[model samples]
Target: MSQSDHDCLFCAIVTGERRGHIVSADDAAVAFLDSRPLFKGHVLVVPVRHVETLTDLPHTRVGSFFGRVQDITSAVERGLQAAGTFVAMNNRVSQSVPHLHVHVVPRQRKDGLRGFFWPRTSYGSDAEADDYAARVRDAL
Candidate 1:
């Protein structure tokens, strides 16, 4: 792909061409809040380099990318006081952004955030959504 390409949403975010609620950033990668979150405090971490999927990235970069994910997960847990966290990556079938990225989802005991195998329901209302955001922000 051309260096100027912005078709990839993660590339846009990394280059500041698209707006994102960024949580953390560095020379190599960035972490941002997921707009369509499965739960509160959900974050998406991506490398600055534009790679279509995990296998597309260099093996060395993969280690660093996941290292950043771990850091983000720790921050999310401390920031949200989350009971636990679930981290995952998608390749061809599950990939949404068509860029290598990892999802760090915060889970709570009563929130019914089971593993990835479990289905998720949408927030009941705007108020509920706001409440969830506030709770996670408070922890942050």
Candidate 2:
């Protein structure tokens, strides 16, 4: 960890210092639901270690991290029964959070969502929210 992780919210979540509703995890990476989702099944895949941006991640960890992200994207599509997924990561500009996180949002044909024109909404309840997480976890 670096001095930045000490103040990073995602680092706290990864380190168990803060609560993140995790969907799936391995030694190298973790996946969790985005609190403010573009869609109901939107997920955020992140590396276990703190890194400011994609370029900040160690070269050796790239495959492990992105591989987990790919798996999570598949799970998002399969678990939510969506036609596909919108898998993306922000560098520094629009990255709301400091830690690197890939967005794997569920999508269907004509779902009315547009590119980068995000329309956010909340999950109905804790149980409902957790079930979304569980679905992706099971799909993994």
User: Which model scores highest in lDDT?
Assistant: 2
Residue-level lDDT of model 2, residues 38-134, one tens digit each, is 8998998899988889989999999999999989888888888999988888899999999999999999999987876568889999999999999
Local accuracy of candidate 1 as per-residue lDDT tens digits, 103-140: 99998887875556757899999999999999999997
**TM-score of model 2 vs. true structure:** 0.79
lDDT of the candidates, in the order given? 0.86, 0.88
TM per candidate: 0.78, 0.79
Q: Residue 56 of candidate 1: its Cα lDDT?
A: 83
Name the regions of candidate 1 deviating beyond 4 angstroms: 1-4, 118-140
For model 2, name the residue pairs that clash: none
Model number with the top TM-score: 2
Worst 10 residues of 1 by lDDT: 1-10
